[model samples]
Target: MHDIDPGWAWSPVEESQQPWTRQLAAHLYRRAGFSATSETLDEAANKSAAEVVAELVDGRTESEEYLAQMKQLGRTVVATGNVENLPAWWMYRFLTTTDMLREKMTLFWHGHFATSGDKVTDPQLMVDQNELLRRNSLGNFGTLVAEISRNPAMLIYLDSVTNRKAHPNENFAREVMELFALGEGRYTEDDIRELSRCFTGWEIRNGRYRFNRYQHDSGRKSILGQEGPFDGDEGVAIVLDQPALPDFIIGKLYQFFIADEPAPPAELLAPLTIEFRENGLNIAPVLKRILSSQLFYSPHSVARKVRSPVEFSVGFLRALEGSTDQYALTSGLSELGQVPFFPPNVKGWDGGRTWINSSTLLARSNLIQSILKNKNTRFSNGTLSDLFDKHRLNSSQEIIDWLETMLLAVSLPETVRLQLQSKIDSGSGNREERLKEVVHLICGLPEYQLS
Candidate 1:
């Protein structure tokens, strides 16, 4: 189950110790974000998977750099100041970004944690929260939740600060139980009431956490059939103890990192939950265990899940030394339903089939056309042909190779290849237009959707 299957028709596994190892690492890194430099990919790929994964799973504290980012980000007490080039620059970061796995994992947490800039109403606060998500993305799941639970940004976004004693607001608590923590059906209305009380005094003041001693309800209440006047942290502690917590979280993590359909056996996940809870919510060890599991590398895992627009866009641009016009890139992503920094709701954009539709397909094709024409919005007669031949890809086979790598994690079948070649060889189609057509076809295909 080592994720090795020679019959699958992927390019042969270059020997790990060979110079191509870096090339392989670059490939994986590119899938996560920007393309890798030879040196960068070599550094990542040279390490054994264990070593590389360890680096990815852990996090570093760059307080000095963080303070700089914070200072540069600039904050107004009003929380709605406009940012300049930094917004576009961040998009660039994701495209040319390093720390490949961290970026990917942080994106996963963004969906899991699920907050939006719209409700938060403060770009800087949202940015801070985003950085926090990235910083702890792979390190610890429980810690991530705990910090997010009290996050001033989250409080404002979900109206948690509005929660009070005379009437406990269940908005934040319910989501914490239903959406974030135990999934759904694991906790009930009564549990929600008690949880809300525990968070009653957990308020945000002038953009900082200010627990109100007066508003706090110290009175006992039952949660998940357990009785207590459990405060906020204690409430989280209690919820984490549930038998299903790990299964819920582990299942989610599995979907993000491995096959979307992969499920953790109750036995495997139970122990993982216990280990996570016992380890102060540190997620690194838990993920190390998960990734190291024999089941993780099962044949079903590789290239199984569909890449999101962010993944597809970033990965393609990295591999092809590609960049797109700023607004169009944003527009293309918007049309695809995965705009960065603008998640749809607190739940974020749902993945998988939701990413595709007739509208989205047109948007993707247009983006391809734009890339081909050096930013032309409309296709001219034979304009695509001129562009392809201009690139000097005289041989139809070269076009096929470019499309294959640019569009797939692996090669396509010979039959598919021949069909594309035939399309290219057709006399009527312009070479550049045909090239664009080929890329468009591949991008539109089902296989191209998968990683």
Candidate 2:
């Protein structure tokens, strides 16, 4: 990666270098959003990579009808007052929503500004926070930081619901610097103390954020070489103004959209960091540049990320045009580790290799098996066999090739491909069951675990 030129890496790929193809389209869709269906991939392959990425980044807004449906579903879940149901609600959106990049970015922000339903308890507040993340997912970073600072779910989760002046809670302050904006070691302990004082009157009352001036500490404080009686907003501005903020955020984004291992060198990230900083932290442009870049379509990023549990399951369902009981799906996701609103901790899921272990790997295979076995699971509103027939996948080779193209990020070994063919030819049960078994087997492989 260090050997790659920063300018050429971020530049658009030429047709001579990498012609737009279904495989490249699949790579873009997998990294940009959840995976796309083969039909979608075909449509995307007809266009230039720039055109496809422009569509993804520009088409951030969901249609009014889709928004209404999502809003109604969210309301229904909140009405039940059960946070457990929220994951299913989001899973439904993940499967059905057309505005893929927005949803994907919302998921990214959910991990970045990690807040859990485990502590917040209020279903409405949690739903509101989810919406908050979605609304600002592709917008201004400074604005997102400002809005999330006063978000009730975040306040409650961070134990800053009542940050009194007498004993200011340092939780939000420390996290705002360490996790949210600047990376760790970018700010000092004294900075956290002073920043916490700035947020002293912030509280959550009646499920909304409120500031009680009486509890605020009005004393002058110094933070990050700036002196002022900074309120929470100003304190956030100061933190966002730090020199390290761009590198920190761009580094994280690189890991998310590019690769998970072999942390990007400072030189490689310099171009993106400058773009992000110059654009006033507008996320869409940076994303647009990254998605259309030469490096994004190259070997470095194609299969670099390990699919998180959400990506693993959601990508499969989306790619196959499959649907199933979302509640059961959410349960399976929980068993596999990522539970939407219920993140494991403030640090979120450690993603990458951490997603796979002996137990979770087994759970992942079992989850796929359970989905395949469930009568409710359907592909294109019918059985898997019917869907495959619709696509005219008659021969074992055609079916295996199609599965390999749509599902796996990396190419299967020749031996593995032959093994899959053998299963399709001789596995137990009817053809549908045999095909399903082959899919299950493929998903269980180490290759399928990658994004």
Candidate 3:
């Protein structure tokens, strides 16, 4: 990363140098969303890399019918009056949604804002907040911060549901500075105190955000060198104005979309930080720039991220065009550490290498095994064998190559490949069972844990 030129790194790749192939298309799909199916990858490879990314960034929007169906499904889940069921609802969306980048960004913001369902027990509130994140996922960062500050679920989770003028709650204020906008060390304790005062009287009343003006602290406050009798929105705007905000947010985005380790230096991120601030904090442009950049398609980013549980499982099923019981899939994800709308804590999951360990590795394997064994699991609306046959993958090597192309960010070791072939050749079951078992084994490999 240090040796890479910032200009060349960000410049769009020329076709003469990096031809838009199925493998590169797979990389884009894996990073931008869940992994794509072979068919999807083929479709993407037909166009220029810039065209595919542009379409992903600007063209994909869920149809009205799709939105209605998802809404109905969400209503049905919330009707159960159990917040526990919300994860399954979202898992369904992850598996089925056509607008992949938007959903992916929504997941990014969910971790960024880091609200949790454990405390905010109302399923409807959780669903509403999820929708809020999705709605503004690819829009202005400032607007997201303002709206989320007043979100009922966020207020409830942060213990700011009943902030009063006399004793203002500092949870949301501290988080807004330390986690959401400026990152740690960018704001002082005094700043948090002053900012908390701005949010006084902001409370949740009858499942809605309410400002009790009588309880509000209308006193002048000094925050981040700015002085004013600030309200919650104004306080948020001040925080957003801080110079550290763009670097903090863009750094996180770099980690989420690029490599997680060897954090990019400030100089390397200077271009994006400037653009993010100059563009009024609009998210789509930054995303478009990153996705289409030479750096994103290079070795530094490809296979650079450790697969989060959601990515590991969802990407596998998506790559295979497989479907399974949403409830069970949600359970598997919880075991693997991430459950949508139920992040472990305010910091959310520390992704990358944190997603891998002996325990999690085993859990990942178990989850894949469970999904394969589940009666409801189906690939291309039939058996895995049927899907493989559709793709003309008859031999073990052909199937392995296909799976590698669709599912792995890196090539499998020749030793592992040989072992898998041996297993498939010697396994004591039918062809479909052998193929499924080999895929499960491949997924357990360290190579498959990336991207």
Candidate 4:
């Protein structure tokens, strides 16, 4: 039903029309990373769409000082034995980092290959695994999946640590096919059993991957119609060779970057699947094609993805050039059903409409309210008047227009816009305080939940 037009162009549009430039920049940032500030959007507005996409895709590395800071934080978290604090530290990084796409992709892979610190309590192990994801965030997908197979946190989380020769654990093997590589029904029950045997010797020791040869089945196994004396590495290699792998990953990328409902049909994804597979499973090329494609700019793709809690949180903070208490932010996010390193289950957050039932919607509003109220919170743009004066916005209508454009992907109705302007004009507080209330209200809007 959701067929892509074959006539769609994959080349980048040099410059969007004047008004659409900022809007498109915001959309790009929301999908590529978190949202960008007005100033950042202005900078991007001067560039071509291809330029922006390239800048996001080829992100710069973190500086040595930044690396030192992250290392110190890691050491402190390990010393305290409070692995939970990892999310708080990460929230701080998300708020302040310039390597937006790298961090954003790290978050994506975290959900894609969901492993929780809750199960594998070693803070160092979790930290190591996170580094692994970040390093390979946009690298070769086959290499990444192979590395993940041996990651210490993954081994423990998927119960592969106890997968011995006699009694093989199927959790890791089953998930590798069903969730990680190929989707359901692509492999049979016997495949899971045989794959488990292939990975039987994988274990963790001293927070690192250790292969125990004696415990390994080391037997000839059949998986994805391949028969071999396969071990964990060979098992992963066979899994990656499946015809279903590219399509499965591309479908996931669509759900993440494009619309969620009316799923992108297999027909719509065939081209991307071909490019991804033919290019040796390197993610950057596929992402470039998708982001630059005519399809990416369509109405069906824009403003269609429901914002996950992390997306919402990161975007809000980035828009205001704001900072909040990390602990409070992490706590609020957990209540909103996403806590970075602690995905709800092995399957991760079922993102899309699932992000906003009644309870979560209310919790999201309450969290924004708390952030606005917090004394520690800081917005680089000062107050509403400062922003208005800086931008020369004298009227409530103009102010509302700018705020709504920056904050919401979808436009508010005429009546609703006027109502918001009225609130801004007559609200009983200083300009900053009133603006905070305005922002709080706008953020709580149902439309704000979308990218």
Ranking by lDDT: 2, 3, 4, 1
Candidate 2 is scored at a TM of 0.98
Residue 146 local lDDT, model 4: 94
Backbone-clash count (model 2) = 0
- Write candidate 4's Cα lDDT for 61-110 as tens digits: 57989988988987888787878989998898888778888888899899
Q: Per-residue lDDT of 1-451 in model 1, one digit per residue for the tens?
A: 2333323212223322233344344445543344443345547656764565566556442356655654564443224464332244356556544466677777778887787755676666767787789778777666788889988888887888888888788888888888787988888888887889999888977777888978888899799878877888888878877867776876677666656554535554455666677876677777766554433433455466777887766665655445555556666676778876667887877786677688877776666556666653322223444434544657789867755654565578899889889888897755556766776677667667776
Q: Each candidate's TM vs. the true structure?
A: 0.78, 0.98, 0.98, 0.96
Question: Of the pair 1 and 2, which is ahead by TM-score?
Answer: 2
Candidate 2 Cα outliers beyond 4 Å, as residue runs: none
RMSD of each: 6.0, 1.1, 1.1, 1.8
What overall lDDT, based on C-alpha atoms, would model 3 receive against the true structure? 0.91
Each candidate's clash count: 5, 0, 0, 0
Candidate 1 vs candidate 3, TM-score winner: 3
- What overall lDDT, based on C-alpha atoms, would model 1 receive against the true structure? 0.66
